[model samples]
Target: MLRLISSIIFRLLFYRFPQLAYSQEEIEEYEKMYSKALTSKSEIKYSSNFPKLHFIQYIASTKKVVLHGSNHKGINEFEPRRQTLFNGKYEEAVFATRDGIWPIFYAVFDRNKLVGNFRNACISSDLKYNYYFFSLTRETILSNPWTSGMLYFLPEETFEKVNHSLVPFDEWISKSPVAPLTKIEVEPEDFYFINKVSYHNPKESVIVSWFLYKLRTKFFIKR
Candidate 1:
């Protein structure tokens, strides 16, 4: 009886708040504009010659698309799934990011290896650039069996902004399945800090002493 009452209440609210809903024609118009913005001359001319920080800033400013990265390839569509995020909360959604560099780490990572990893992205004090830090265990860094992955470009229409106070990256989540408009294959070498990655022990906290990090990197990391 309670479930039925709740359903009726929700239906009444939805109908009463009609302005909160988007019409199918409005949604289609938004998608068309997003697609056009993505293919604009400025977006087409973006190249590696520009600093990665600049690229991220430009994408965030445009808000035309969100990015998702994964080690698995040949993915035509992304379905909403339950995932545990850094905050220890489980959510059912398709996660994406406005920050361009954050997805690159996910693309190159191999979860099957089951090793420790730490990654974070932060904006500079002036808010003009983004800084990234990542570390992996000695064995994982040395073995490095995985070489490539895929970065997916998803339309921004259906995604909602995630308000995460603990994380610095601009994250978005969509409950509906998303089909990628395009995807790019990326290698470890393509990551900006691939050579500068530090070493850490899984048992310990993410923080590593400067001296210990240097010692481990010198002996174990292969660059």
Candidate 2:
């Protein structure tokens, strides 16, 4: 058939003209970014310089996270992420599950430390961990040759970047149900981030985050 003839011709051409198949230039660009990330210092410094959407990763660890995401990727991706938050005197730690939550990556911010977390299992089952940041549009494990993770700016910056669409931080928080915004909605309307984060390919450990939600504030329905 014509398909068989085309296959034979294609193989013959590929073998005889190998240069036509490979682009060495593209590989060079990828390698440059790869080395730049490995050599960068502020990349791992306590203070970060990359933008909210720019990606970063740890040299010592396989984990990838957002540096400007107010110390967390999922939180910083919000339309208005917070910078300084007041923690309660009590040790406020608990499972911060959300409504209609899907299997995704979450970043936790605690005491200046940020960790990207994910879930592999459901909340109803034994509740095991998942490790993969999902690309909502691509529907695949989010990864890049230059950087493995991404970070979004804090809600304050978002407010500015989005043409002051958001109100003052104090006024915004006052309108919320709690003293501070805890659980954020990531629907298309609220935030149009192209990617949904978790983690990709986790090792033997609790990959999910216990500190993702704020430990300081709690909301009561008061029905």
Candidate 3:
């Protein structure tokens, strides 16, 4: 009975989030990069290229690129870390991507640190593609106002490059660790949100899902 249930769950997951098949060569490369990054003892510092910035959220499905409270606006409130940034200190950044939902990826950081350089590499949950290595300094954060939270959507074309450059932020932070490493576990609900945001075929499915409609209307729909 347990085996049967396990099989059913596996099938359901596969159906909902199809596994991406990567070549053996690609898999080997990611493993190599991940191993090297994990074992490296080199000092990782934040790059000077990143500007001092902070963001509340991002909306890519619109015309005007709106950055809600970005560009070092909240740095004052983000004290201690804020001082570090001003002192030219760099925060370590780690990257990861989910399977089934290919494009929605994440770059977790050691508390208070933003993305460092753009040459580091990290591993992926799927082990299919790696994470992108990009600096998330004030300039990049202000320039690229993306939807907030752990969830992010990037173009399909850039997926490969992003994955190859995945650097483990936690690994770097471990050198002179200040905070605990964050392990982000993507939930099923997150997958649903990514799908709704990234691939919305209004003809095939309703743009405003039932849950969203309820949330939007708040039980005040008139007959």
lDDT of each: 0.59, 0.23, 0.25
Q: In model 2, where is the ten-residue run with the lowest total lDDT?
A: 162-171
User: Candidate 3: how large is its RMSD?
Assistant: 17.8
What ranking of all candidate models by TM-score puts the best one first? Answer: 1, 3, 2
lDDT of 1 by residue, 18-125 (tens): 112344654455445445645651122223443433343344455578888899878878999998655567889999876666687788777666465554432221
**Candidate 2 lDDT, 63-106, residue by residue in tens:** 22111212233331233233222121222121222112121123
Per-prediction count of colliding residue pairs? 0, 15, 14
Q: Which candidate has the highest lDDT of all?
A: 1
Cα lDDT tens digits, model 3, 77-121, are 111121121123553422122222322223222223333321121
Clashes by residue pair, model 1:
none
TM-score of each: 0.64, 0.19, 0.24
Best by TM-score: 1
Compared with the true structure, model 3 gives a TM-score of: 0.24
TM-score for candidate 2, residues paired by index: 0.19
